[model samples]
Target chain A: MYKNILLAADGSNNALRAANEAIKIASLSNESVIDIVYVADYEKTKEDVLHASSADELMIERRKKIQNVEKALKDNNVSYKVTILHGLPGPEIIKYANERKMDIVVIGSRGLNSLQEMVIGSVSHKVMKRVYCPVLIVK
Target chain B: MQSLKQQWFGNVRGDILSGIVVALALIPEAIAFSIIAGVDPMVGLYASFCVAVIIAFVGGRPGMISAATGAMALLMVPLVRDHGVEYLLAATILTGIIQILFGIFKVAKIMKFIPNAVMIGFVNALAILIFMAQVPHFIGISNMTYVFVAITLVIVYTLPRFVKAIPAPLVALVILTAVAMFSGFELRTIGDLGNITQSLPSFLIPNVPFNFETLQIILPYSLALAIVGLLESLLTAQIVDDMTGTASNKNKEARGQGIANVVTGFFGGMAACAMIGQSVINIKSGGRGRLSSLVAGSFLMFLIIVLGDLVVKIPMSVLVGIMIMVSIGTFDWSSFKYLAKAPRTDAIVMLATVIIVVYTHDLSIGVLAGVLLSAIFFVVKISTLKVERKNSHYIVKGQLFFASTDGFIDYFKSTDINEKEITIDFSNSRIWDDSGVAALSKVKDMLRDEGIEAKVIGLDTSSQKVVQQLDGISSSH
Candidate 1:
């Protein structure tokens, strides 16, 4: 029965599953609202700026990365808003979660950057270690 | 703000440990860069201590280490050799003033103009330069020196496999210095470079006349130092930002560097900037805040007070060995594959950057040449004005800028037009400048001479405005 929920999504299939899980938990409360937190990592932003031909194209690409989670919220008639954060995904998500004092943080077990995760521990794992709220990591 | 507290103290234990490691590594380098600049070794050490501490509070990039660096040292050689240390101090002050102006004007925005090819070349050049400077101590030194260098290299490269807590370079330094001392090895040491004074650097103006003649003497050198220092610092800041997965206020870092240099000049020290090699060491050792840099500066002084005697005895061979490891780590070895797979133009830019810097011993000039060559290539590629002919419709299908205007005329002049009337349509392209409009009118006149009427059509609003304004004046010509 969480009133304040943070859904960390990146439009991947795992993120879609996590979004569904967040929606199920939010339905149990009368005034529950969800915040969809999408983190655009600094390295990813650098690569994208280099590759994209125009600023508008970069914005469109970024929007596409979190489109699925937004679609899920709209279809469920859920009261939700999307917030874009920048930096390392794990630390940025945790900082936002702590600052907002969320009741729970629902995140995917796996992310889009598998190679990077292999090198540096996974984002969800880092979030579970540091975030001040309950973390529900859906596989 | 509460964020300031988080930035300084959020990771205290990790910061302190990493700072100590950086302090240990900074010792050999500060001494070596002083020898390169032809100044007393204490000058470089003083600058490193002052800059690192000041930038910890004033700089925009958290966790980045600034110090007396080889690039800045290379630039100071002529000034220090020609006028003396006092004049060099005056130049350092002027350099700081110029850099503050650059920061206020927000020079960080220009960083985007430096392409990735140039950056790769700059990095490779730096690594090569670092390696090259160690050659004198590396070869023909002595048989004993060789053994110590080999052992230091081994310990630096292989120790991380068994040890993760302490930095490899620190271990190499401590263990090799101990063995060299006890074994009675008669080898080159840091003391041969210069003496490291135990007392703190006192504040005093350089003993130089404050006049127009003095300004004239130091201005050129000061300008060179300012530009080179800012370029290296901003580039280093960008690298640290990428490594730490954060963004930095590059303009603020510029101003902070100015503050550091200004204070350093007054305190009998040379100008300095951020060091990429030490920064990578900082990051690898888990440093991620202002406290790390503050501790690095403080502990460097602390080490000199307590261990100054032993630090001067550090065998040059051991430092050379550690530097070799640093150079190997600094180079982007994957760039070998990058040369074969990347575009020929980019590859050429990268190579030109390396060759010019290595040959001229000037980082700014090489970077300038690379940027100019890349820009030339970019201009040539973007000047393609595809003029298509479908029946009597001549469609200009690319940007009609100054660079493309010559090609615009050449396309029509070389072709044989057998139509009585033809339409030159700007439906697909926009006219950008006066040269484009003049070319259009010139082509119209040339066609008119052949008894053919050409009508221009399909101009976008802005392009139409440009053409209409320049059309009558240029057609009269």
Candidate 2:
């Protein structure tokens, strides 16, 4: 039973599929809880802050990235808590998973940007390569 | 220990290769910035080597490169022009001291105050400045100079597509210099600018009188240099952090830049800071550790010592073309889109920053103005004191500051309150300064003239305290 499941969500369609997988794994054990992690890349802080009317609006923008996944999780009755991490998606996800000694990580095979993934390798690839726990890649 | 190892030598092959590439890139830049600062090319070269090497061990950002930057050079033009290299060296040392103090005092906390618009403006302004400095070298000099420059640009921009082993700028330098030398083309060479001593830089005190007069002469320039140097350094570090998805010790970097500049000054070199162009080159080439910076600095010295004679024979037009490339790379071209898409105030701040820096040729002043302008815009944005009426009661919201006080008074002057007893609520808003309280008193007087008794209620303890403390309000109570 994957008791401590870490789900990486980025509002991508693939991430919703990953969340469904996380719910499947988490429901196996009564003690299990899927920890939903959304990483807001620091690279966009400048543009995001400039475009946003206020700090509240900036948070709303970031929250929108995980809104779909949260709704899916709610519909499944999966026990979960959302945590926002700041930095690069792949490395920060890896760091968070390792630090918490996550029993398993469930991430999507692709994210919002295929071009970035193609150029620098995907976040899932980096996470799968670096994370110490078992990683479930939902295509 | 685990993370330190990861930070230093996480990728060896990448670090060294990138380091070498960065070293090659630094040469033309170091020499070009030297000429811009009006010093001998060796001073800039020595400063780049010293700053890069020292910053590797001591700097807060591991992957970021620090060396003789054009921003610092632009700041130095007046100093070097007025009192010569000795005074410039003196100013460099003093600049280091000021930076160290800034680090100790944790000035890095204020970096968030620099909005993105201003940052884009700063980058674009610096790009404009870099291009402006290179104008006289190749402009209308000769048809030959123009040809060499065009060829250099072509090679630098296009060669990277075919060749991945070497840096494009170095390739441009080598190929163009060889053609000019072997073909005996009449060109303005680096040698024509200034004599470059082939020997290594040595420790020597600046030959300026140790008196108050000397301090008075260099202090202003030193302060300006320190501020601009640290600003650019911190900005570059932030860029590197975003690129690598890692955090940096910014305060430590401030001190490290100070230490590097101090050592560089003692070694008879001008002040230096982070070079963004070279830094991006390092990142793209797979540099991810302090070792890359170490290699970059040491390898630059190696190149200089082994190829000093060859360096002098290089045509200045090639350097001009490369610097033009640098300016192109340094400028945030997306800022054009940003101006169209961004808020009006943000656009103004960015444009103001660019125009002021380009006009004054002083980054510190330009940045100061941008920060001040942005601050004013921010205050104006947040101080939108809203007075919403719900029947006989008025609810006040948002910050009530001096800036919004006049508007708060005007709201009362314009509105005709029909209620005999109108309750003004201050529960949702906080009053700041005496002007806010004075505005409240003026509102009460205006409402009284309208034959309406304003019953003030919902005052938070702090707002009540402020209202009671005002002289007229105490008598009215």
Candidate 3:
């Protein structure tokens, strides 16, 4: 049932938990694929650039963060693929999942929740409803 | 009649047309909301009256009419259903009293905290929910029938092209009603539930026995009403402010709303809030002064007294049509589309709000979800806003506020982990508020936690002076 699992990482503790769970699930399955996705919310690059330190420098820093995740996967002895996508994190993850026909998705339950989540929306809830495959949201 | 220009009726041309437009719109909404709130439709009407009259006079923003809205209406359902109508009214009155206190205390400052992203998400989610909710009405079916879906789709696609200033929902209502009524097409109508009351509202409250259990039961409903009322009124004030290039006195409006709800409760009415449709209609028409809303309220009373039978005669189909149009107009589709292209957090927040609102029965849950999502977006958004490191120390000038604190932390922590000693060059920084102080304190804590040495420079002593002081204090050669 857990052939191809997608682990969502937002550099948050919960996402790491979900990642760990995905790795454990993969290890248990023995014949499964693990994929890590980090979505860089770069939609406001132009606005952020005006007040930001520097775009090139930020990208370098972001790449390094992703590389760290890659290193973590390597250390865990998990054969994994990492995708650093620039788009809405939830939708992008869902889109990637649907496109790949991933069997399951794991994410942190408490990733980046704020007051705006009350009136605005949450990514995990949206994915839980929209996605066809099973999704595990870990607190 | 008074002087030539002082006719009690005001300008009949635009006002009457706008009134009819507003009436057409309000009637169905009032009815739907009454059912949603689990109260007699008359309560909704009465609420619409009280809110319109009171806010018209005391409201901060002109062209912003207050009324019994679906958001507030839905909250009443559990209250009326669980505690009976009498207790619900008592809670409403208490809510009003609280609102007045909010006004006196000037609690409008809270509105500022409502982030723009959350606001947009809220409006967008409301738009989708309202649009979907009206599908059955648009297609000329009322009982969640499948036939209405095709009709709604066809009408949604084709009607806007043919219709102009006359709202499409009205057209849909007329056509559908004609098809249903004249052609004897099988469908449901408000007439099916019960006869539309032909009698005017008498000043009376049901004498159902009340208890603390009842009050406790209605607590959630009142809180829900308060949140919905606050959100709706503030949002409407914002819209009116945008339209008229005016600013809103939020605290005053909240107090005003509170007063209106209390009065409404006393009068056997449900919760009331600022009505976006009526306000826009008021502006689009010749409603210039508080008189417009006052007249709207008085007009409802007058109609109930003199033309109750005629009002009851107005087809539910017509009201449904007006609502369908309103639902369509209320939706911020373009922004919904734009949110798709926004930051992942924002997009996620918006989508989650829409889903929760659509699926859940409780309105507060959706709002709570949206707010939490927005907070996350704010944090992440602020985190991405970075500080530049100039020289050996990090120099950050400008307002070192809470909004930019995350970015500062991210930059400082990442940099300090690599650098041995660092100074936050804040001498040139303009500390706007205590939020800056809080951020600085946080940075201090983070440095201590990470076992790195960090200090604030250029405060009482200039950066150069601080360097000199440090050099003078150094015991090592």
Q: Per-residue alpha-carbon lDDT of model 1 for B410-467, expressed as tens digits?
A: 9889989999999999999999998888889999999998988999999999998998
Worst 10 residues of 3 chain B by lDDT: B1-10
Ranking by lDDT: 2, 1, 3
lDDT tens digits, residue span B70-163, model 2: 9999989988888899999999999999999999999977877788777778888999999999999988899999999899899988887678
DockQ: which is higher, 2 or 3? 2
- Clash pairs (backbone) in predicted model 1: none
What is the C-alpha DockQ of each candidate?
A: 0.10, 0.13, 0.01
Once model 3 is optimally superposed onto the true structure by TM-score, how far is the C-alpha of residue B137 displaced, in angstroms? 7.4
Off by over 4 Å in 2: A1-139, B1-14, B379-386, B389-391, B433-442, B445-450, B457-473
Model 3 error, position B354 (Å): 3.1
Task: Tell me the tens digit of each residue's lDDT in model 2 across A1-139.
Answer: 7889999999899999999999889889889998999887754543444444445666688788899999998998888999887666898899999999999999999998888777678999999999999999999
Regions of model 1 farther than 4 Å from truth: A1-139, B1-17, B209-217, B242-247, B280-288, B341-343, B378-384, B390-393, B455-458, B470-477
Worst 10 residues of 2 chain B by lDDT: B468-477
- Each candidate's fnat, listed in order, reads 0.00, 0.03, 0.00
List the candidates ranked by DockQ, beginning with the highest.
2, 1, 3
TM-score-better candidate, 1 vs 3:
1
**For each predicted model, how many residue pairs clash, with residues at least 3 apart or on different chains?**
0, 0, 29
Q: What's the TM for model 1?
A: 0.77
